[model samples]
Each structure stands twice: as C-alpha cells, then as structure tokens.
Target: MAPKPKKKSSKFSGGKGRLSRESKPVKWIESMAVDMIVTLKKISSEYYHELPNRPDAHEARLFYKNIPTRRNRYGDIPCLDKTRVALIDARDGNDYIHANWVTMPNARCRYIMTQAPLPETTADFWSMVWQENVSLIVCLTKIFEQGKMKTLEYWPTSCGKQFHQKHGHVHIRNVGVRNEPHFALTLLEAVNEKSMERRKIQHYLYLDWPDHRVPICTHNFLQVVRYVDEEIANYKGKEPMTIVVHCSAGVGRSGTLVALQSLVGSVNEGQVPQVCQVVSMVRKQRAMAVQGPEQYLFLYWALTVHITSCCQIPLEAKKDLLKRLVLMKNCSTKSACSLSPITTDQPDAATSSARQARNEDGGDRKRRPSNVKRKTPRGSVTVRKSKP
Candidate 1:
C-alpha cells in the first residue's frame, strides 16, 4: 500500500477526539441565520410580488356596494365577502363591516381580523363581537398615531365604566385592568340587553407598536401572544371562542401578530415553522396582510429569535446568532442600516446582559420611557349613552 493514504480527518471530529455538536456552534447558527435571510429575501422579492389582488365583483361585492361612509379606514383595502364577518342582527339591515375570519390550516383557533372600530361603526363592531362570542380582543393600534385618529375609543377608558351600544343591544363594562410596560389587559363584561346574557372578555392593548412599522422589541410582542394563548387555554366556554385582532386597517400589524402566533404555536408543537406559507394563507383570508417588506422580514427575525432562545440550541451558539440577527434586522433596509449601534429588547437574562455589554461599547445610552400607566380601580359601573 503506497504508504497507506493518510487517514482523512472527519468533519465531525475535532483535534484528537470526536467533537460534540456544540463544538463550533457559531458555524451552525451562522448557517441557520444565512438560510433565514435568504428565504426572507426570496419570498419578499418573488412570492410576495406574485400574490393575486382580490377581484372587485366576486370577492368584494359587498365591500363595493357598502356606502362610502362605511368603507375601510384605508379606502383601498378590500374585505372578501367569502370570509367576511356579517353582523347577524344589524338593526339597519346593512351587514357590512371591514372584517374577515382568518383561519389557518391545522390551527386550533380562528381569528376575526377587523379594522379598529370606526366612530361610526362602533355599534356594528359590538354586534359582531357578541354574535361571534369573541372573548378576547387584541388591539394593535393606538387610538391616535402621528396625530391621526387610528382607532376610536371603542371600550370604556376607566374601570367600572360601561360603553353601551344601544343600536347593537350590547353593554360592555370595564371590570378590571392590568397595565404592563408594553401592553394593557382589561377585563370586560359584555352584556346583551336583548337576551340579558353576559360574557367575560379580555382586551389586550399593545401600545408600543408603531402605525406602519413592526415593533422594535420582539420579546414584548411575543409576551402579548403568550398572554393571548393563556387566556384561550383558560377559556371555559361551550363553543369555540374566536379571537378578535385589529389594528387601524386590520392588515399589517394584525396580520403579523396572527402569523407570528401561528408560527410560534407550530414550533412549540414540534412542527417546522413555515413563515412564507403561513403569511400567504393569512393574506388569502385577509387582503394585504403583512403590508411591507419590513414586516415580512420581521416574521423571520422574530421566529429565529424564538428558536434561539427557547429551543435546545447551544447557549453560545444562540448568543452568537442573536447578535447577528440584531444586525440583520437593523440593516434590513437602507434607512435602518444608517442607524448606529442598534439595540434590541431581548427576553432572557443572558441576552439582556449581552445587550448591556454592547451598550457599554458605545451604543445609544438614552433609554425609552416605559409606557405603562396605572390601572384604574374597579368601582361602581356607569354606562354612557351614545346616539345610534
């Protein structure tokens, strides 16, 4: 044997010994990050561009026939008739609301995606909530954003106050409230004046989300999803409770939240998360879901962060990947890239410490003030009458 060919070193082996998978973990994380970035770019540029626009006649006939006053907050957004949520008991016999039922394949729960209740459509909004037996409302937009009224103050602002929608025959009482730094949880009791029936509802108001952009903190966003899931798990209703999710126009932020929640659930169940497919499915149910390339990219970034933090990945590898992810998210666009020393709101203590270390290394030192407000005390219920 010609001096016996030197034994080839195994890629899986380290110097003089077999290496555990954890060895050189950054390499593995790097590969994963690269794959995610590539997938996001391909989907954003190709598949997202090719999505068919909903036709006017068949898909959105009612949307067009509805009076201009009742049309969507954004004039161009279409609500597909096939999946539109009709007001079953509209006193005026006009059953249109800019809302749709978004059901994901193999999902246990369904979502009612709707625009934030317009001042004119508040009664219709309450009608749908009562008819659909919706117990959880996830509000993604603030009442006002950039000096424009994004959503009407549909719910009672203080504890013990009731918002009575006489036209819809619904009375919603603010029973309790728990305010957090990023969101507020209000316990509401919805009563049907017609049937004298009462149902408990939870309203989650996410205040940090910007009007047209994704939330800067993925961890906080996920916390909202977790809270929603917990409420769903604890539900004791006889029928399946549909979740009501809304932003201003009920497409971008709402869609992102739905997609994120679905993917997170999929991952927790040991299934592979398909971001592009999930988003496409959501858009089919609700037109223009995940509105921009930034929001689309955010789904990938958020899912990656979830995996690195929650899964059984090596700790060192997870840290490395997260740092790289922050860079990727911050530099996803030319405008985003111009900002120096990007900081992300990470969940775990390790990640938080790492962020602190990075901040010490010449990052922006100014901290954002917490948006949490004191919760109003529960007191005597007072109903406010509004003109129909």
Candidate 2:
C-alpha cells in the first residue's frame, strides 16, 4: 500500500473532515497563503542575485537596437523597446516617452509602468497622460530622497501654472490637494492651449513607501489600493482608462505594488492567490518587476494582512498566525531587513487635512510621526518604537 500522505502542518489542518462555516474560508485562505509564501521564498532565494536571462521578443529587440531610446536614470535598467508605449504622432507629436502598458489576465487590471520622470521627460509624460486618457497616476517614489533628486516635480504645485512642452502646451492647475495619513490626493485640471479643451485627472502620491524598500505595515498600502480601485470603478467614460504607476526605476517599488494589487484582486474574487505567478506575469509585461527577494516576500505579508482584515479573524488569532506564519521568515539581509509590529486604523478626514497642511509647510520632516523614531540604517527594515 502507498504510504499515507503526511499531515499538512498548517493552522487550519486538524485531522480534516468537514470544517466549521466560519473556519472553512479562513482556513482555506490561511493554507493557501502558507503554500504561496513557501513558493515565493524558494523562487526569491534561487533568483535573488540576478534576473533570469531570457531573450527579448524579436520586435522588442529591434526597438532596443534601432530606436533612439532615452538613457535611463540608472544605466543598468533600460525599458524594453518592444513593450514601450509610443506617442500617437497623428494626435500628439513625434517624441516618444518611456512608459509601458501592462495588463494582468486574472485581475483584469492594467497599468502604465514608467520611470520617474526626468526634468526633460516631464512634458512627454504629461503628453502621454493626455493622449492615453489616463485618469489615475500613482507615484510610488519621492521626488527627492537623501538630498538626491529621484523624480521631477512634474505636476504644477499651485493652480493655474502653464506647463509648456516642445510638442504641446497645457495649463495644469491643482484643483485640490488632500493629504491622508498614508497618501496624498491631488486633483488636477489640464487645459489644452490649442483647442482650449479641458480634462480632469487624479494623482495619488503614496508617502509611506521608502525608497528602494517596502513598507513595514501593509495595511495602509492595502487601503490605498482599495481606494484607487473604488475610484476607478466610478469612471464614466465608455473606454476604460489606464492608471499610470511609477517609481525611480519603475521596477522595484512600482512592480511590488502592482503585483500585490493583482494578487489582492484575485483573492477578492474568491480565488486563491498565486504570488509567484502574478510576479512572473508582471515581469513578462515590464521587466525586473518586484526587483528583490525582500520585495517579493512583502507581497505575501500584504496579502495575508488583507485576508485577516477581511475575514474578521480575531485579533489574538491574527496575531498568533502573523507571528507563526509571517514573522517566522528571516528577512534580514544586506538589501532587506525586518520591520516592527503593524498598526491598523481607519482613515480620518480631519487628520488627513491637518497632515496635508503640515506636509505642505515642512515637507518630509513633518510627515514623520513625532512619537516614533527610526532605529535602523537606511535601506534596511526600519523599526519605529514609541516614546516612553
């Protein structure tokens, strides 16, 4: 006789027969999460050092070879010419910007993953937004990090600022700017100088994400994702609009956020999430998405947190599993580090407005919570402790 299958060591696994109604969904999700994390960790460990070498599609190689592509901020990372988005010359102009259109099959989600806009490329960036009829722009990196300029201030800070470009000219006005605990919302109005026509766009600048790193708590990030999806569902036009997302390189942080969003989307649809599959699909569309193992691991944590929050798992039970299933993984490495415990709270409007004003006046300094202080070096998992 064949040997009996080994008992699955999971929180939900208890000499399985039939599970209780409440326990069934939570147990299924928990088991699925464990398997997903193991697979991701294995994949990350094997490919942590470098991306797998794969030949580019023929047309993409042609663009890489023949087309005049702009030099990326980092010489090492280049946008594959084949997947790069080209300007609608007949409608916009001849200049092409470095942005790619990525769509996920299961999630039915689409994104324009582009690099942080250079000063010269800012106009082209706006041009692409206008031509593509993009309704949302998700900025994942800070404009400046450690006194180095990471991304340009592409949008008009104040209302009625005329932004001029070689191919097109438009007046960009900031209609409203509201800052929440984790992210900022800026409503923009763009007026075409030639036709005097106008359009509205929403910009979400997520502040919690550190440069070249992942957030300690995924709660706020999930809130932002939910907020964006809810807003996208309200689009009035017939053609679905694309959401533009970017970080400094458009691969690391940007990729992580997109991958997490895709996984969460699948889970919300009552399907088990496959983290590695989502990451691989995204990488195929862009390149080097979810850049490192730490980031890859982060997607799992964010998804787990989401499941617990949605499933109404008891705080003690959630905490126990978090300690056992999530924190058990060793995250410390040269490029990655461990984070402190997570805190989850509902978003407050008044607090958001106050934070916005403070941010406007003092910039990043005011954004740091006063009761907490960073206990780790840069590029590591920063731990924040409350003041005694």
User: Which candidate comes out best when scored by lDDT?
Assistant: 1
Scored by TM-score, the top model is 1
Per-residue accuracy of model 1 over 114-153 as CA lDDT, tens digit each = 9988768888899888888787789998898999999988
Q: Global CA lDDT of candidate 1, please?
A: 0.65
Worst 10 residues of 2 by lDDT: 7-16
How would you encode candidate 2's per-residue C-alpha lDDT over 278-301 as one tens digit per residue?
887777777777776777777766
State model 2's lDDT. Answer: 0.60
Cα RMSD, model 2:
12.1
Off by over 4 Å in 2: 1-25, 32-71, 90-95, 159-167, 328-388
Residue clash pairs of candidate 1? none
- Model 1: worst 10 consecutive residues (lDDT sum): 1-10
Q: Model 2 has how many clashing residue pairs?
A: 1
Q: Cα RMSD (Å) between model 1 and the true structure?
A: 13.9
